[model samples]
Structure formats: C-alpha cells, structure tokens
Target: MIGIDLGTTYSAVGVVESGFPILLANEEGRRVIPSAVWFGDGAVEVGEKALRRRGVSPVVTSVKRLMGRRPGEVDDFPLPLDEGDRVRVLGRTPEEVSAEILKELKRIAEWRLETEVRKAVITVPAYFNDAQRSATKRAGELAGLEVARIVNEPTAAALAYGLDKLGEKARVAVYDLGGGTFDLSVLEMRDGVFQVLATRGDTRLGGDDLDAALAGWCAEKAGAGAVDGRMIKEAERVKRALSADGEAVFRVPFVDGGESIEVAATRRDFEHLAAPFIERTIDCCRRAMHDAELSPADLDAVVLVGGSTRIPAVREAVSAFFDREPDLSQHPDEAIALGAAIQAGVLTGAVRKVVLLDVTPLSLGIETFGGLMNVLIPRNTTIPAKAGEMFTNAVAGQRSMSLRVLQGEREMARDNWRLGEFEVAFEPAEKGRARVGVQFRIDENGILEVLARDTATNRDTVLEIRDAAVDVDDEKVETMVSESVEHAFDDMAERVFTEARLKAEELLPAVEAVLSQGDGIVPEEEVAGIREAEATVREALDSGDANRLKAAVESLDKATEAVAARMVERAMEEALERRMGG
Candidate 1:
C-alpha cells in the first residue's frame, strides 16, 4: 500500500516500512517533489526537474484551481506549446494534465519501494466541493491507481497524530496552510474513528500570497525600480527565509536606466508586509471553530501542517487566539504525506481498524424565482449525504423544465457559482399539475449526482455532472503498468540533481539579501543580534540541515511580524476600496 499527498506546491509518497510509516524518497533519495510541471516539445515533466525550468519550461503550477471549471473558463495562460503540437488540450482537459503528474509520483513510489503497487489512498482538502472531488477521482484513474478513498488532508493529519493517542477521544483542530490553499478543520476521535465536525477554508488563499506581498514591499522600500516576475519569485524565497531567522538582509541586484541597484529585504520588513495574510488565516480559524459549534478552548490540540505554519508570528497568533501554544512536534511538510500513506495502509487491509467520516464544505442548492437560492443540503453535512426536492410545472401542460443547481453560501443565484444544470422533461399534463421528483446525492468523495423522475409518465432521467476525461480505460492502465516495468532509468539521480539546483538557486542569495537589509530595519545595537541569527541560518543552509533551515525560517518570521501585519492592512484596505467603489 502507498499513500500520496498531492499538494499544491509539492507532492510526496510514502509507505509503511518496518512497522513505521516512512516517506519514500524520490529518484534523488529526497522525500518531497515540487508540485509543478513543465510543458515542452509535446511532453510533460513534473516535480523538481519541472520546477527548474519554471519560466522557460512553460510550467503550470496551480492546476488545482481549474479542476472543476465550467465551459469557457479562462485559463491563466495558453499552455506552453506551439500550434500543431501533438498534445492538444482543446481535445483534452485539466484532469489529464493533473493525471500526468500523479503518474510521475506513482512511478517514483514504485521505483523506490521495488514493488508492484496497484492501489492507494489519496488526500484532498476537506472543503473541496463535488466538482473538485470528481476531478480528483478522474486523475487517479488516469494515473492507473484505484483510488479507494479520497481522504481529507486535516482528517488524515489527525489520524496520523491520533494513532498514538490510543482509545482517548479528543477534539482536535487541524490548521493546514499549504502553497496554494488553506484549511481549518475540527475533528473528534473516539475509539479509533475520526469524525470531522466542520471544515472551512479559502481555497484561493495560502502562503503564496504572503510571498507576493512581501516581495512587493521589498520593491517599494528599496525603490528597486520596477518589480518583475523573477523579483516576485525571489521575494517568496526571501519570505520563506524570514520564517526561520529573526532578522535578515540581502541585496537584490537589478537593472534600471542602464544602471544596477542592489535592492535589499529584511526579515522584519517581510513580516510587516505579510501580517495581514496571517490574520486572514486567523479569521478562517475562528470561522471553522464557529461552524464546529466549539470554541478554541474546546480544542484539545492544534496541529499544524503546510510550510507556512513554520512562521513564528503564525504560531504566536494561533497561540494567543486559542489561549495555548500550538503543538509543533510534527513535520509541517511531511505530516500530510505520511498520513496519506497510513490511509493507504488502511485501504489495503494492512491496517484495518480505522475509518474517516468527513463532510462537504458548501451548501448545494437550486436557483428559484427572483434569483433566490433554496439550499437542499447545508455545508458541513456528513457525507454520503442525500436530499430530495420536488418540482412542478409552472405553466399548464408544460412538458419540460430546466433546473439550475449552484454550490455556495450567497443568497442570490448570481452570487453563487453554478455547478451544473439539467432539464427534466415531463409527460404532457395540465399546467402546474405534473409532479417531478429530483434527488441530489453526494458520495463520500463529495461528487454530486442527480436523478429525476416524472410521476405521470413513470419515466426516470439521471444526469452525471460531466467533466473532461482524465479517467483512463482498462487498456491504458495496462499499458502504463507495462511501461513501468520496461522503462528503466535513474529516477533518484535525476531528482537529486534537480533539487540541489533549485536549492542553490533559491538559498545563497536569500542569506545575503537578509544581511543587506539588516542595516535599514534594525537598530545599530541590534545589528550583531541579527547577524548571529543570520550566521546560524547561513551555516545550516550551507550544511544542508533541513531542520536548521526550517528553524531559521521561523525565527525570521517572528522578527518581521510588524511588517507582515502592515501588508495585511494594506490588502484589507485595497479590498475595501474595491468593494466601496463598486
């Protein structure tokens, strides 16, 4: 059995070895894979190697956003390809692209374990809606793995933690903020069963926003001429560095008017730029707690995941809000992936004692008169939830009527996004006399299915919400399995080379940038204080101490809270201004 954490920024695979869940290293003997892919020359390359050529490789980093898009949804960019390329997306879909990445992860897992693995469990956000869940299932098929269950990320984290908790039941809050998404979940564990009380999150919000905000601040403070895409990317790395160090400084050399100016960024300044983003997460935490009908005081423990959780201020704010310090024993990046492997073990009957019962994130409803929305199933309802609503003909002798279904919280139909629509034709009848019953059901994975029947005609109509096919056929899965055995190459060597290159590209300048900004952001007396922290991080980054790098990142985050807070205020102001103007 194998488990996969298909995260927005990175992916990882793991399995139980010698009675302990150990993350299986990639072809490079490293555990994590960058959740990025490069498109070139009619081929798709994933993970670290794909991330290396981000700009040059026509990479797609946030395909998760497009998972359940409706017809005519605009793509961020034309996929990296020339006209007449053999891989035509118009004939394909986002699921296919995502599946390609999953295939790569599976290949790495099978290669490292030296085993034939045909089944696994995958983890996703607890708040993911039906369309998103269905899309994931399809991706699993495309990768040639039978997806036994789509476990929620937070629930999985709790399971991984609760496995050691034994028979005691505890109310736990899982705070997970990954590269591209954030989720807060409240769960209850009793007798080995993990039941989710509530889950809430902003699917579009995450650590990436903090990096962008901090980078923009760095540009403004140093007057770095103009901010470019690469500068923004650099700001992200710098912000990541600030999470572990108390104060940092570096010079960002760039061109302006035939001259070069070295722009500097400090950990303090970065935090000032990012404080508001952290606050946003706090707001989400509050909401999730409310939805669960519990207060922070009710939580037994707050478990953190995602790279962003390493920030000191994030920990402090969470601690302050909940009136207790968070438990930081788990590896933020590896916990979810490890939990996924455990779930996989459960699915394969290697571990048979656990079951996960999760819930949907939003209400499912239909549009009614005056653009009002009538919800059939409210958000946070346990899955596999089911509800039925009756329909009638509005006009005499009307034979058919259209049903528009939406998924969201708004009262107005226009405000809520339409998941899909179906038309039910009824037998000819007196106007307003025909009775039709429509049943909406959400499965464990959160995928929606609708069935309608005309009572007068005794005819049944069913609609399966349609999406692009990433689901593979039997023949394709067989072929992929064969390719796995026949194609032999050095996967680890390739992964290591890619990770080392990316690390080198991201870190060296990161340390120096922190040093350069020290003079401007801290007092003269504090210079040595900042330098000492910087020195420790420099040694760790140089020595390749993952823990040290991780610590340095958090220390920097604490020193820079004021800056991140200011950025948060600015973001909130801009949002308010936009709403006011509208």
Candidate 2:
C-alpha cells in the first residue's frame, strides 16, 4: 500500500519501508512533484517538467481548487466548466487531469519500492464535503490505484505529529495552510488514538493568495499588462527567497518591447501585501477553536503544517492568535505525506495505532465588535461540536461585552440570525489584560450551551443558547450556513546562499559609496564602527552560515546608516550648489 498527499500545488507519495514510513522521492530525487500538467504536440508531461512548460504550452495548474466544485458553486476559475460542473480543458475533465498527476505519483512510488502498488490511501482537505471526497477518490481510481481511504489533510498531519506521543492526553489544533487551501482541525489525542473534534477551512484560501499578492505587485510595478503565469511563477520564486533572507530581487528581462521588470522586495513588503489573507486564516482559527470547545489555553499545541507555515510572518501571526509559540517540530512539507504513509502501514499491518477523524458543516459563530461573525463552529463539522475562545477587553475600564450569538454564511455578524444576545462581564483592567474564556458546547441532543469564565476572578457564566429560539427568517437562514513550497531543490546551505549573497550585494555597494565620501562628514568613531561591522559581515560571508551572514549584513547596514545619511546630505548640497553655479 502507498500513501499519497494529492495536494493542490504539489503532490507527494510515501510508503512503509523496514517498518518505518518514509517519503519516496522522484526520479530527480525530489520528495514532492509539482501538481502541474502540460499537454502539447501529442505529449503529456506532469510535475516539474510540466511546470516548466507553463507559459510555453497548454498547462493546467491549481486544478485541485476546482475539484468537486460546480461551475456555479465556485465564483471563478481560469478554465471553463461544462454543464456538470466538470472543468472543460482540452476535452478532459478535472478528474482526468488529476488522474494524470496521480499516475505520475504512482509511477514514482512503484519505482522506488520496486513493487506494483495496487492499493493506496489519499488525502484531501479536512473541510472537504462528501462530493469533494468522492471526487478525489474517483480521481485516484482513475489512476489505476484502489482508493483505500480518503484521509483529511490536517488529520494526517496530526497523525504524523502525535503518533509518537500517543501515550499522553492532550488536545491540539493542526493549522494547515497549504499552497492552495487552508484547513484548521482541532483534535484530541489519548491512549494511542487520534480523534478530530472539529475541522474548518476555506477551500479558496492559502499560499497561492500570498503569491498572487506579490505577483500583482510585480505586475503593477512593471507597468505590465494583465498578471500572467510567468509573473506568478516569478513571484513564487521571490516569495521563497523572502522567506529566509531580508530581501530578494524579481527580475524579468527582455519583456514586451525589449523592456525589463525588476523589483526588490523585503519580507516586510510581502507581509504587508499578504496581511489580509493571513487575517482570514486567523479568523478561521478562532472559529475552529470555538467549535471544538477550546480556548487558546486549552490546546496543548498548535502544530504548524503546510509549506505556507514556513513564512516567518505566518508563524508570528499564528503565535499571536494562540497566545503561544506554534509547535514547529514537524517538517512543514513532509508531515502529511508521512501520516498518509503511516495510514497505509496500518492497513498493511506494518504499523499500529488507529486514527479517528471528524469534520464540521456550516459555520457557527457569534458577533463581536465591528459586527463581524467570529465563528465558534464551522459548517460541515461533525455533530456534538464544542469549542471556545478568549476575548479581551477592547479598551481599558470596559465593563462588559455584548455577546450576540449568530449563525449563517455571511462574514458580517449582523447578516446572520441571532439566537440570543447577552452580556459577559469581567473585572476592569487595562486593554487586553482582562481575559474571558468563552466555550460553546453542543450536546448529542443538539442543545447548544455557552460558558464564559473570567480568569481574573474565577467567575463562571453559562447560557443555554438553544432555548433562545432561532430567528425564523427562512430567507436569512437560507442565505446563512455556507460553505467552508519549500523547494526540495538544493540543501539548506545552498538554498540560502543566493539570498544572503544578494543581501551582501546590496549592503557593500552602499557602504562603499558612503565611506568614499564620508571622511570629513562622518565621525571617526562611527567610521571605525562601520568598518568593524563590514569586516564581520565579510567574515560571515566567507563562512557557511547564510543566516549569520544575513544578520551581519543587517548590523553593517545599521552601523553605516549615519555615515550614509551624511553622504546623501552632502551630495544633495553639492547638486544644489552646482545648479546655482550653472
């Protein structure tokens, strides 16, 4: 048996070897394959080869986002859809295209194992509905592999993280922000069993949004036409570069009319462009925790999974939201594939320890300040859902917050019907200092109850919201309840080499320019400091630690700032004087 993570942007395969599960690399020694397919000149190419042919040939990418979704269901797609919501591309449906990718993965696994793989387990987003799940299985079958089971992405990640620590009892939330989709799953692990309590996600959101943000910025800066696939690919490259170093350059030469587009981007610039998407993920995290009847304090850990989590900004945001540092032990890209392989091992008697997974349905949340629906429970989630969140005082001296229980599809709190409204109070304190842990529990009887605990005074408030009577506006209700890469190329040392070198390129030029003219303008003490900083940077540049070089470059940039400022002032004065003399 083989396990496959059939991802949106990339796909990976794994299998048990010598009683341990490990990912199987491709012919090029890559653990993951780009989820791209190209067809041209009566030939079909998949993975890296196909990805490279993006602008040159008819290639389809990011098809996973359209999987199992109807044409009307999804707002838009790059490809056209048939009457059945099947993606119509070159007379092939999305499933068929997906099957092609699957076939390639099977090839890799079979080649690596030197055995014919007949049965395999596949993974999908935790929030995927029955239709999406079924569609995924169909694609697997089309690839000529027996679809053993469809595992949830987040569940697989949790399995990989907790399989070794199953003797302990703890609740964890797997925050999976992959290349093209996001899934937030709350799970409880105890007694060698992994149980998913609640799961929520947005099928349309993920790292792709981040890339698009940067790509759009690139296009705008280039004054180019529409955002093209080439620009997007370059953006992905620059995004990866920005992940480790301070900045990277996106250069596209010989463009339309013999021009070029070159833009320099810092990590902060990318973060600013990607902030809204990150905030949306944060919103889902809050909602999923509430649905699982968990406060930030309840979770033993928030395991960061998926390639997007590699971004420093993303890690910081998750840390801020959970009030704790995210668990970074798992390799962001390999954990899911490993978990899938573990599942395969379980089926083949190579491994033990069972995993029980669950999901949520329509989102259930409440209205907080700004009339936004803070989801307590996401839709398509399994029944008997319970979750919680920690609310803080928005301002100092605030006595209470009006808790409006809301249910529906809209993001705005006012658009959803209110089951009830009440006040939850805590001791007055400085802003964000007063904390209230609010938990929601839905019993098997379908009763919804909410509990608010004031941490400062240890006071408890309970509200049985089910008895409050849901607003009977069928129209409003109908409008509600809605739908829910680190390149393996080069080792770490080689990967950071270019970015660190680029940082050096940017720093040394300005440093040299300033020192050449700063003899009289800059103080001798600061010049010595600048020289020392530059020497340290050069020493680090000679060493193998790219990260150390980045830090040293930053220090040198700081040390030379005053001198550079003086040079700039003198040059401006010289230019003004020259203009007056002329």
Using lDDT as the measure, which candidate wins? 2
lDDT of each: 0.71, 0.78
Candidate 1 lDDT over 91-140, as tens digits, reads 45667777877888899888988877787778887756565677888888
Stretches > 4 Å off in candidate 2 = 72-85, 363-582
- Candidate whose TM-score is highest: 1
lDDT of 1 at 3: 87
